[model samples]
Target: MTRSNTARRTVAALLTAGVSAVLMTAAPAHADSNDSCHPSGAMPRVGVFGNEFAPAPSDPLVRAQGWVDAGLTCSPMGSFGGYRTDAGGYAAMAWRLTESMEPSELLSTGSVTPLAGRDDLAPGDGLLNPAGFGHAVVFDHWADDAHTSYLGYEFTAAGVQHRTIPYPYFAGQGDFRPVRAAR
Candidate 1:
């Protein structure tokens, strides 16, 4: 081959290799798993919902906040009335709004705290300090009758995703408290 043709082939080969490398790195870590339950196309997705179980906020950060980037600050969403944080790093903050509510107001909101171990959580119940990561997730459902598996919308490094985690993982971590919010 001529000198010019040889150089062109070499350039093409480099371009192909570069594209392959990018594709490999971009692939999902878990091949068999998915992130959310949105495929249902139903109102109040199985796990996390925004503003009265209507639907999750369009903004990913608002839907689920994580440790590093986006939605790092926690705030009460609505009547369920609790606190959240996407605050990055090892920073931990707890805002106890439940203590100030009158008995009547508390009844109206049906807000309960630290109830994870005490009762069978229903879908939509909020999980505080899940996985001991100081992360928050909305209870989706139990993966099994024994309650060994848990599914929820977790605010993760991959953004808000529908995740299924083993109970032992969180149990080992300790301090999994459940809070229920009235619709």
Candidate 2:
């Protein structure tokens, strides 16, 4: 059979079993530490609130594209953002879908759809910054049982970095929404 067909069948079988079982437990076996995710000699600067590897690009679409490309190149899981090159991840994909429509027509469409709630979040989900100007990252999973905190993988100005942010933190930062990848 073709590789694509084989891949689809494998995915179908896994989904038939349960996708959460796969996402919840598929993180790299390595411990959660800066050393584990980031390469040597590339220590992200410690910050008062959040770590800043570098200044993110002013344009949200540019930033999103950079994040997905960087993740594809270096994520230990083999696919960092779980995004394909053609679609250009969430922001770019969303932009593509909404471009033809009038600004006020307001149709939000893309390779992803918003999650109903945080309870529905899973690893590999796309986290959007917000409606107009926004950024995106790959959800890594909650870091605590209370579900108050979660881990995320995003490409920063410095490079690809794993981020530990609280659940409410995203909202406070105007990134209150999370979306699941369509594929």
Candidate 3:
């Protein structure tokens, strides 16, 4: 064979081998089995809405403050209000606007604090704190008989658009129901 022809074949073989190596090393792109909020074969499409708090502007400010980069998953079975995080990602900040609102005691201690801005607490006061505000909040509203709603908020925090999903209603609270996956 001609020298040029031999060179061309060697180059082609090397290219093919390189391509195969890359394909083998690549991890499979599969739906997160660990994610409870995401249904099987469902890709997570994050959408941002308005803030949960108004007048005082809690939602906008929270976005502006920016939370840590974290992954969250919520499932329907077991505890209706249960939440999970991405191990380590972004930190959260909490802002308790009401005197009766305490997030740490409620989320961690499993104790229920009075809803902020209720008749008992001042109009603008709701348990607002920065402690867990920067962390990603995920709620699994898809479980049957689960009365939790998942809300995703997008706001500019430190000049960046941050996305947050909060479960404000759970277990006989606001009307939160799961959505069926699109066929």
**Which has the greatest TM-score?**
2
- lDDT score, residue 81, model 3? 10
Q: By the TM-score metric, which is better: model 1 or model 3?
A: 1
Q: In model 3, which runs have C-alpha deviations exceeding 4 angstroms?
A: 1-61, 68-112, 116-148, 153-183
- The digit string of per-residue lDDT tens for model 1 on 16-59 reads 99999896467344211222211222221122223443223433
Candidate 2 lDDT by residue in tens digits, 107-155: 2544467788888987666566543323455667799999888876554
Candidate 3 global TM-score:
0.20
TM-score per model over all chains? 0.40, 0.42, 0.20
Clashes of each: 6, 0, 27
Ranking by lDDT: 2, 1, 3
- Please give the CA lDDT of all the candidate structures: 0.40, 0.46, 0.27
List ranges where model 1 is wrong by over 4 Å.
1-112, 116-119, 130-133, 168-174
Q: With candidate 1 superimposed using the best TM-score fit, by how many Å does residue 79's alpha carbon deviate from the native?
A: 20
Worst 10 residues of 1 by lDDT: 87-96
Better of 1 and 3 by lDDT: 1
